[model samples]
Target: IENSGDLIRAINLNGGSTMEWLVDRGGGQQIITVTPRFDQDAGRWLVGILTEMVGAHTERRSNPPWVALRDSFVNTWELLVLVKQGMSGAFSQGSAPQLSGPIGIAQIAGEFTREGGLAGWLTITILLSINLAILNILPIPMLDGGRLVFVMLEWVRRGKRVPPEREGLVHLIGFAVLIGLIVVISANDVLRLIDGRSFLGG
Candidate 1:
């Protein structure tokens, strides 16, 4: 719920005046619609309240006396990890979606803007952010989440570590796969642009 609230707030900040409620359909499909009650002022107020709560908690911990500093640090670390996991889970699903390249995203953004005005563009931006967060947490080599996983394995094994050569190879493979996906998506974007279905007034 917190993550959803944050996403809503971000969309509002980006000039969205309508909320598009989405529901999952079978087999990765979704049903979405724009609602009338998502006024910008209400969204901003919610964001401000959440921000204040977060800031107050941090300030209280920071000003604690010297003797409590270590305990505070430990608590803060645990809280941070929980928050991060929550955020990651909010963005991720069991499988990856079709990845979009920069060109594809630009095309989609423009299309949305043309179809539904500012609110549509804002919705697309929010979804893109969620997609980006999910992609980063993938267990592919060279990503932060992948490194974190390796560290966990090392801890569990009490001494064993992933070999440097194997790690390098994994990263290289992931990089190549990512590049190929980008190329394919970009080509699709170009074709869509030529078909006049992408971008606003193109």
Candidate 2:
């Protein structure tokens, strides 16, 4: 294929069918047969080849403040959409969810800071902040979304409120569950670091 996008599209279109290809190398023609495999990361089928633009430029360009802000919003919206799609497919058939905990976050931050310097650090910081905001707003107890849910429920009940003891109990249980999840995720992170394998076989 000419480019990576075209290659991916071609493979996806081909689905599970075997493909035959003609290759030109060193003034000789060769035939190759291959089958596409499903890739969880891209959520698509691939033939395990890397392709790039014919004449891609690596130089960075500066944009005006307004244009930069607009692009930032656009990128954030795209990320949100991607996250929504991932969440929807997280539990789908033959799909496994991958998560990073505090240790993983630290490793990622350190790697970015060392390899990409200031730009990478700032980018990761912003992403983490946005992730925290998203998590806080999820409809789970002991979070802002949980409080909002209670408010919504009270409004629907004509100002009637849930008992203080019950609300406290629910929040406590939620907090415990949250802590347990963090611990489990952290342990998984440690295991991945030790073995270089994903928790759910990638």
State the TM-score for model 2: 0.73
Per-candidate TM equals 0.46, 0.73
Model 2 error, position 166 (Å): 0.7
Off by over 4 Å in 1: 1-99, 198-202
For TM-score, the strongest prediction is 2
What's the lDDT for all of these models? Answer: 0.58, 0.76
lDDT of 1 by residue, 40-153 (tens): 322221222222224332112345587577765664454444344334333443333333579878877878888768878886786677657666887867777777778888
52: Cα error in model 1, Å: 43
Candidate 1 — worst ten consecutive residues by lDDT sum?
38-47
Tens digit per residue, CA lDDT, model 2, 35-108 = 87656776655678776576854557899999999999987775565555454445453666567889988877
